[model samples]
Target: MSNKKPILAITMGDPAGIGPEIAVKAFSDSAVYNLCRPLLIGSAAIMSRIVKELNSRLKVNSINNVTEAGFQFGEIDVFNLEIHNPEDIKYGQISSTAGDIAFRSVVKAIELAKNGEVDGTVTNPINKKAINNAGHHFSGHTEIYAHYTNTPKYAMLLADEKLKVIHVSTHVSLRKACDLVQKERILDVVQILNEGLKKLGINSPRIGVAGLNPHAGDEGLFGDEEIKEIIPAVKEANERGFIVEGPIPPDTLYALAAGGKFDGCVAMYHDQGHIPFKLMGFVWDDDIGKMKSVKGVNITLGLPIIRTSVDHGTAFEIAGKGIASPEALLYAINYAVKLYNN
Candidate 1:
């Protein structure tokens, strides 16, 4: 793994969504080949269909194992998971079978990394309801990876260029998220984000922690979560010799981060981190009624094996149109390579 190309197990997210299409689009760039050998971990039949649907000339090379992948730029080496009649799961339609296929691919990717078969993993989007309908019962990929890898101290970190963010709690109700924001939880996420920043090449990272309440509790006028929960965490981090800042108003923290004022931000909850970060990454075009572009990469910090994903959703309305943006996937790959190198 030293001074050589790494092999990345790229899960072809739910076939019913734009995962397959965006993956194909990302690989078409060819420059990605110089970074790592990408092994597609999903249905070969579906990859072949996506290739044809996008009018791509690349051949789909179905393989039985990771070593079987040629990893050639002009060819897509699919670690083919033969699902039952994959053709039955049409594009843009949710099905339990599709969810099962997506879940299995991720499971295999984790195995490959744990067994030292691959360097890291880049995941595509999977539908939560579809996965639960398949009986997986996980909120999202972050939870799935944490469960499989036995990583209890994990946080979701979203990175787009210079703007990096981690949530104190994610995949929970807003009320629960508020209640969960104790000093211990904040400290845990702060530590995770600190390590994550270093892995991304930010030495001596300056971190900004967002307040759970408006205006960071407005000096206890809005809420006590900041005074009771957040400030103590920030104090502990400073005492621990980490460059930490905050109970900054959540509204203003992201703007300061976007302006390069801090190395990363600690979001108190999911939407607190996600809303502004997505605003930085996802651009909607009102005139066309579609996304003009999509950006940002989601990294699960505190896992033994590296996992990165596109920040966007399944985009069911535009699944097979061959128009979905692969920008985020490319960023995810770049970040995976960066983490794997470290």
Candidate 2:
């Protein structure tokens, strides 16, 4: 393996969303250059337009391959995909063309990582509706990554600072999500979380599993998922020599995890995991009527290749306004580097 700095392939998400804006802004930061060689895999025309729209002074160099990238300070190297028309790039509008481009960028990034052209990938937020409109038929980034890479046992891990969470099920309806929770799935997620935490430098990480029902089914009064599925999984994990806890109450597990009681928490479904993670990472300013800061990194575990992404989505309304926060992407990039190093 190469001992040099890890090369990260950043995919520019939906052209109509904040993906392009943030990509331009992220490379403008001098600190990003210091960590690793960042190469953008997206439309060069759209990126150039964003740089101009944002009034950024940084220069963007279009390259055909990773070796051709300059990786120099004050310069952004973009591998031109040429998938979008400069005139067709409209903010806050969804089009099949834009969706196809976004899907292609992700596919290319996975291909690069699988081929060892890059160490890992950090993806911008993609619009699910748009991607589906383009006939790609992916539910989200995790699904797409899993499909293209043929990874069968993948899970989504959300990280911000010390708090890390892995989900048992995501992108499914509430009814289906509840039914999908089982001992096998829960155990798989726990194992993935334990392995991931270790890679993040946590030795013998403590994992807390959240119950699927309200108030942990009140000990079978509210639901039996905790007793039937969650508890069994936790017991199995503990028997395997993992420091695992729970079938804990969902309401309080997040608080305990946030309080640093555990290294990571295993959530039952999408909202159960996303709500608490976002609440901690997203800071809303009521006076400004907007988010003050958006944080967190979404990592897809069990893939053949390493993939991390901004924990938020495409903010189409702020696509060209130059106000998009690149903090999440920065965090994702940093985490991707750490994962690569490990």
Q: Candidates' lDDT values, in order? A: 0.91, 0.90
Return the TM-score for candidate 1, rounded to 2 decimals: 0.98
lDDT of 2 by residue, 116-226 (tens): 999999999999998899899989999999999998998999998867999999999999999999999999999989889888888889999998888888889998988
lDDT: which candidate is best? 1
Q: Mark the regions of model 2 whose C-alpha exceeds 4 Å error after superposition.
A: 1-3
Q: What lDDT would candidate 2 get against the real structure?
A: 0.90
Candidate achieving the largest TM-score: 1
Summarize candidate 1's per-residue lDDT along 1-342 as a digit string, tens digits: 357888999999999999999889887879899998998999999999999999998899999888888888899889989899786788888899999999999999999999999999999999988888999999999999999999989999999886899999899999998899999989988899999999988889999999989899998999899999899989999999899999899989999999999999999889999999988888899998899978899999999998999998889999887788888899999999999887
